[model samples]
Target: MTVEYWRAKIWGLLHDPVLKALHNNSGRGKNSFYKQLEVMKPWVETGKTPDQSGGKVLENILLADYIASASDRSAIGSVTASINYAPGKNREKGLEITHLLSGARQEWKINSHDELIKGKRKDYLVQKEQKELLAKVPKELQDPSIKDDIKKIKQLYWWLWRCLPQATCDLFKDNSLMLMPAETRIPDASIWSHVSMTSALAGALAGYDLTAAQIQRWQGNDELSHPYLAVFSFSPVQELIKSSRKMRDFWAGSWLLHYLSAKVCWQLANQY
Candidate 1:
């Protein structure tokens, strides 16, 4: 945002997730993710034009762009990213990004996801729910012939679900099967709430036309650790409290998985 921050943007090392994954700390010097960030300056500033790269990095760019953009702060809240341009135990190089993002000296709080979902191995995504959907017989689907459509849906579902904690799999495995009904087997609000929050996050980043009712509906979630479900469907789970956490969180899990699957893929594919 400022001249000093721009210096970091130009001279700072790259800290994006994909670059982190690609350029590990195998002791690669200037040949680091930071170098790649420097090389991609034009793309980072002006953004990818008609002729450019594609695939997941581009997807991440779109996500990162929206997240880092000036307009998304209120919706996503004060954000923190694990990625830092500078390397060291506590050098606080990445904090610069937050400050730059916040436009305040020491005003922003950007902590490292040193142990978040980014560089971590993904497991919750490959649960039985997703496997069932993938392994389903041609007859199981309404139209198996819709090959590309089905693949895209399944992939998006996997990414969104994996983004959540592992407990998510245990919560909504049945609902993801698609053979189940909406009420009995479908995911309840408990599970769905997290997904909605995730959806709200991605939607906010993607600049989707979210409605006030939708935002308000997700605000009543003080039931659990946080009220994030306020933007999601966890209210239903709390409304139907049960002794068994297992049964209670099922619908929420399913709803989150399904809804995020639809929303994430739709957002990326339909981005302007």
Candidate 2:
């Protein structure tokens, strides 16, 4: 077979799992925010703490609220949340995610006055959304602390939506990627850490450039790279990482060597 043919086959192998995952889910589908929370209700009702789930339920809550409030007509959006650290040099500074909520709006190109007004708007929306979402939580699960935790998630989603400017919105509308600052609250060995590490590893494999031929080719072949496309949607990590060798990296960074290299490392780590 030709090199191009092999590349195409490899690419297909790399992306099939991600494609299936993304295609099979949606915000309003069985995987909807309310649906995910419903699945978690039993646990919360049984008095399971967030740490007991290793904060996984909390992660789901965060993702759910984010989709409900910020995903804009689709379960998928250009909400790029990942970690960044210096490559090769200054690695000891550690990976830092963007912490942007309390910062000034000038960097986001939004006027302070407008941001203040928008912040209030978002706050109102959060209040309304929080109450509605919490209402969906079973009364059995509505302990004071659980209610408080969901409220905090509401605030977090609002802060995230507010920090993102119209330009970023437009960019997503145009199906372009927009990198946001890192968040500080993500903990060690958390799901966020896996996400961050996956993303960082993807970037490293791509040399932090998206314009590479392989990525560009994959972008053309698979519409998932750009969130503006109608076919593109968010897939759960559980689905994305399922019984697959290269799916996560392919979905995370398109076509890159890390997709294969990470597969090797994953297998090696699991062997023990």
Candidate 3:
């Protein structure tokens, strides 16, 4: 087989898992967004004005983006909650799986958070998630079938661990990789987290039937204050590491905490 063919295959193996997890978790309204973008494509490509229906589509897109972009940290006080709310008299509730390989746990020294963060802690052993999410790669890349293309295979390892994570962090503004700052000015939370939270917030705001003036007033002035947003935080790092004997133990505890917290966030996001 050609060297390029093998390179492409390896790339697919690494890329597909992340895409699957993201789609499974955050795919609601994705089709609608794609359709709306398609409708605006012609007008976007040509500098032509849209018709009435097209104009309305553009308006909704702009409104959603504006509401999505606003942040509570700024004086604007964010309208993300308003976007999540839709007019619905009856409420529906159910359980759903939001991600692939979510049920699988990492095979390592520690199993639970208590073991990781408390008691005689062990070194952080690097591990991957379920084989389903992160498929095993060949241990040796120097196979005779691809001896001529060994360089590319070696490069794939660097790309998988370094380049791919950096790209995702840059694109989605997710700093989970912690390779570099996702945002320069306000390097706080992940954009995906913000997107999910705002979606939930919008759903809450939809029921109020607030007037444009009221929303504008809330955005413009800080006087009309009601708890429109809630901030939840996790702390106690020192306590979590009280029993750590080595650097690896602290690292293991932190990773376990982050992994568990992410699972909780995924469930909460799916609930809304």
lDDT of 1 by residue, 101-122 (tens): 3344321122322322244222
- Candidate 2: TM-score? 0.24
Please list all clashing residue pairs in model 2, or write none if there are none: 97-182, 98-181, 98-182, 98-183, 99-182
Backbone Cα, N, C clashes tallied per candidate? 13, 5, 8
Alpha-carbon RMSD, each predicted model: 18.7, 22.1, 22.8
Deviating ranges (above 4 Å) for candidate 1: 1-51, 54-64, 72-147, 151-155, 158-272
* Candidates' C-alpha lDDT: 0.30, 0.29, 0.33
Weakest ten-residue segment in model 2 by summed lDDT: 15-24
Ranked by TM-score, the better of candidates 1 and 3 is: 3
CA shift of 111, model 3, Å? 44
lDDT of 2 by residue, 206-251 (tens): 2312232332234334322111112323345456545357767646
Rank candidates, TM-score, best first. Answer: 3, 2, 1
Best by lDDT: 3
Candidate 1 global Cα RMSD: 18.7
